[model samples]
Target chain A: MKNSLLSIYNIAKKDLLIELRNKDVILSISGFGTIIIFIFSFAFDVGSSLSSSTAAGILWSSISFASITGINRSFMLESENDTLEALIMAPISRDIIYLGKVVGNFIFITISEMVILPIFAILFNFSILSLEFITCCLLANIGFSVVGTLFASLSIKVRAREVLLPMLFLPCIIPILFSSIEATSMIFQGKGWNDLSIWFQLTVAFNLIFLIFSLFISNVIYED
Target chain B: MSNIIKNKLLTCSAIFMFINLYLIFIWVPTEANQGAIQRILYIHVPVSQISMLAIILVAVSSVLFLWKRNQFWDKIAISAAEIGLLYGTIMLLSGILWAKPVWGVWWTGEAKLTTALILYLIYVSYIMFRNYFPTGSQGQRIAAIIAIIGALDTPLIYFAANLWSEAHPPIVLGPASENDSSFSSNDMRIVWLFSTITFMIFFVYLLRIRYKLQDTISKYLTNT
Candidate 1:
């Protein structure tokens, strides 16, 4: 178990190093995310106090779109280098490699989200850098990365990978997307912790299910 | 699996459907609140339930396909996915038909409708993925993973949709909604029971036919 953990960490570290060199993955995520926030920023009055829920919806939908594209690029890069096949050929278990990619994807998206959130707060006139907000966003990002990694790898070989990725990814992520949006909205509205607990539980539970299921499914999909 | 069984299923499904139609029309008294339109429930509810069952079948068959590495399970999963999409379309259409008169709108973004629509979209995309992916074992494995995720997503979607809908009130409840005790008469129960049975049989027959078509096509291609 410790060895497996080490392997996962190593794979994640390797992925991070590669991402750092070109920075393509992070740039694509932030670029796409910024464009979305830019559109919403211009569409709504710059200083208008948007409804907390509307702000939450805008934040999440943009994240959803950007993160999916980010995931597609993450794997696309790996495939271009043939590293995915090499990793699959390695002695380490497939799930370990999958978990590694998920971790790498999560960190990349989170870093970009940090940059994106402040801009959204300024444009939408709502602060969301609070502890509760970060917690909710992290939970949602975990979900996005977990499900996205699996679908990205699965779709890499498809004829229409670009078009098909979002279609496959969105439906599966709806629960996480809604839970995080609602949870963050509640926090923005100054709702009690008791109310936020349900959404928290939902995001955590769905993330766990998708995480475990993705690991299990990875073994089969990655097999020779 | 055999001609005799298929024929038996076909005959029994026809007879039961006829009996269910009779029960829906003549046997169950007209609901005073909604009048004759309430009869759509007999078709809608059963189809909805069976459509959900089709999703479960897809998931289970997908799991078996991945575990056993058998094409037969893949065939079952694909067949169920196609049929689930059909039944979901029927459910949605019937719902809109009833909602127009009862709720004063063709559809509402209510919990039930929203959940059904999302679940239907999940399967539709699942079918679309199977179509877009190439015909190969790797494609089958990926599709199976999609099926499993889609099935497991149903309950979470229902729960989240329920929570989200509370912020926006649904239209006035039309009587004979599954929740309405007034609709729970012995007559209603009888009609619902037979209708569900008829639908189940029809589903089974359709599944067999779909599976056979798949088997024949694959066999023909291999021979050619």
Candidate 2:
């Protein structure tokens, strides 16, 4: 068990280190996220003062799109370098590799969110700096990373992976997106913590379920 | 498994479906509230039920494929998914037909319809994933992983959709809403039950044919 944990940590660290060296994934994700937010703000004319729910919808949608771009790039990086095959060939189990990628993706997406959220708040004229909002974002990111990593690996070999990744990932994470959007909107609306509790629980449940299932199936998917 | 049995089953299902169409269009009393359009329920409800069933079958077969490493299970998974996609499309169209007159809009973000649409998209992506991979164990493995992950997410999707719908004022547009208690009547129940059975048989017949087609294609590919 300790060995497995160590392996997972090492793999995750390796991926993170590579990402740090290149910085392409982070730059692309943040750029794409900002562009999406800009378009949505202009399209919705947020300067006229948007409803909290509309703002929440726009914010989450941008994050969702950026996450897809991030996920695709992350796997594409591995595939381009043939590192994915090397990882599979190593003594480490596929589940450990999956866990590593999940961790790596979670970190990347969280960092991108950190950058995106401040811009979103400034542009949309909403205060999203609260603990509840951050917690919801974290929980949603975990669900996204777990499911996104699995789908990213699956789509890595496909010719049209650019199109396939979002197609495969979005529907699977609808519940996470919905709950996060709901909770975030509630926070923006100044609703009480009790109102956000159910969405929080739903997000947690979504994260746990997908995390476990992804772990279970990752080996099967990677064992080409 | 024999050709004779396949033909018999196909003929029986065809006849059963004809009987169901007659009962739906002619025998069943028209719903007073929705008039003739409500008859679409006979097709919509049964097809939706089968679509759900088909997805569940895909998930089950996917798990079994991963566990046993059997090509047969993979065949079953793909076949069910294909058939499910077909029926799900029918469900969506019939739903639109019913919704236009009843809901006064062709589409709404109502939970059930949204969930069905997402589910259909998921299946479409699943088929695309299967096709993108070259004919090999690798493709099958990836598709199985997708099927398993999708199945796990299904309940979460339902929960989130229900929560979203509840938070907003209920849309009284769909046939499954509280106001449509027509199924509470004995005749409606009987007819619905018969239609459901007929559809189930139809699902089985289609699945067998699809499975055979996949098997033959795979065989031909290998021979070539």
Candidate 3:
């Protein structure tokens, strides 16, 4: 287990090093997240009758949509550079590769969320810095990252991946989307732990199930 | 051997289906509240159950295919996903038509409805992924991963969607619904039980035929 953790850390570090060099995925995800917020404001007609729930909804929805680009780019870079096979052929068990990717994605999305939340706060006019809201974001980000990584790896070879990833990922992640949004909305509405616990537990369950399940199938996911 | 089994199953389901139609139309009393619109319940509910069952069937078959490295389970997974989409379309259409006069709209983001819609989209994405990914063992492996994740996500989807809406239909056709169903008349209950069983058999019949067709196509592709 120690060796495995080290290998996972190493793989994740590799991803982080590459990302730091270019910052393409992080920049695009944050930019897309901001654009999503703006578009939703138009749809909801900003400043007329917006509620805290609406603010919470905007925040989570942007995160979910923006993270898709990050996911696609993560794998796309490897496949596009012809490095997926080299990584898969490395001296490591397949699950480590899968876990590493999941860890990398989870961090990338969290960083994007940091950039997004403050911008969302200013536009949607919410305090948006409570401990409960931050807790909800972390849980939701983990859920999003795990499922996104699995499908991104699965669809890496598909020709229409740009269109197909969201089509595939959105449906699988709907529960996460719902759970996090509900949790965030309740936090915005001044609901306490009693109400937030249910959504948080659901989000945690979703994350763990996908995390274990995707690991079980990750060997198949990366195989030739 | 396969031909004989499929023929027998098809004949049995057809006879059972005719009897089911008779029972549903002539025997069961029309619900007073929704009137004729509620008759869609007979068609909608059974197909809805089958569509839900298909996700589990596909997921199990997918797991088996990945573990055993066999084409038989792959065939089952493919056929089940395609058949699930067929029933899903019927379920969605019937639900929408029924909802028009009853719910006063064609669609609502209600818990069950949202879950069903998302499940249908997930299956559709699976089919799309299978087609877009190159035809090979790797394709089947990735598809299995998709099925497993989708099945695991099912209950959470309902939970999250439930948080958004409370208006719902009563349970029918099971022990749990014995006292829960609003339409608990003996005739409705009896017909619903029979209809559900018949539709399940029909689902099996279609599954077998589709599996055979997929087998032949794969064999032919491999031969050429």
Q: What local distance difference test score does each model get? A: 0.86, 0.86, 0.84
CA shift at B73, candidate 3, in angstroms? 1.5
TM-score, chain B, predicted structure 1: 0.93
Q: Which stretches of candidate 3 lie over 4 Å from their true place?
A: B1-15, B166-184
Q: Please tell me which predicted candidate would have the highest TM-score against the true structure.
A: 2
Error of 2 at B40 (Å): 1.0
lDDT of 3 by residue, A63-160 (tens): 88899988999898999898889889998989999889988998999999889988888777777778898888888888888888888888888889
Task: Give the Cα-based TM-score of candidate 3 against the true structure.
Answer: 0.91
Model 2: lDDT equals 0.86
Off by over 4 Å in 2: A1-5, B173-178
Worst 10 residues of 2 chain A by lDDT: A215-224
Give per-residue CA lDDT, model 2, range B72-147, as digits (tens).
9999999999999999999999998888887667877787887888889988999998888777888888888888
Give the fraction of reference interface contacts each candidate recovers: 0.71, 0.88, 0.93
Write candidate 2's Cα lDDT for A46-105 as tens digits: 668888888888899899999989989999888898888899999988899999888889
TM-score of chain B of 3: 0.89
* TM-score of chain B taken alone, every candidate: 0.93, 0.93, 0.89
Interface RMSD for model 3 amounts to 1.1
- Candidate 1 shows a clash count of 0
In order of appearance, the predictions have TM-scores of 0.92, 0.94, 0.91
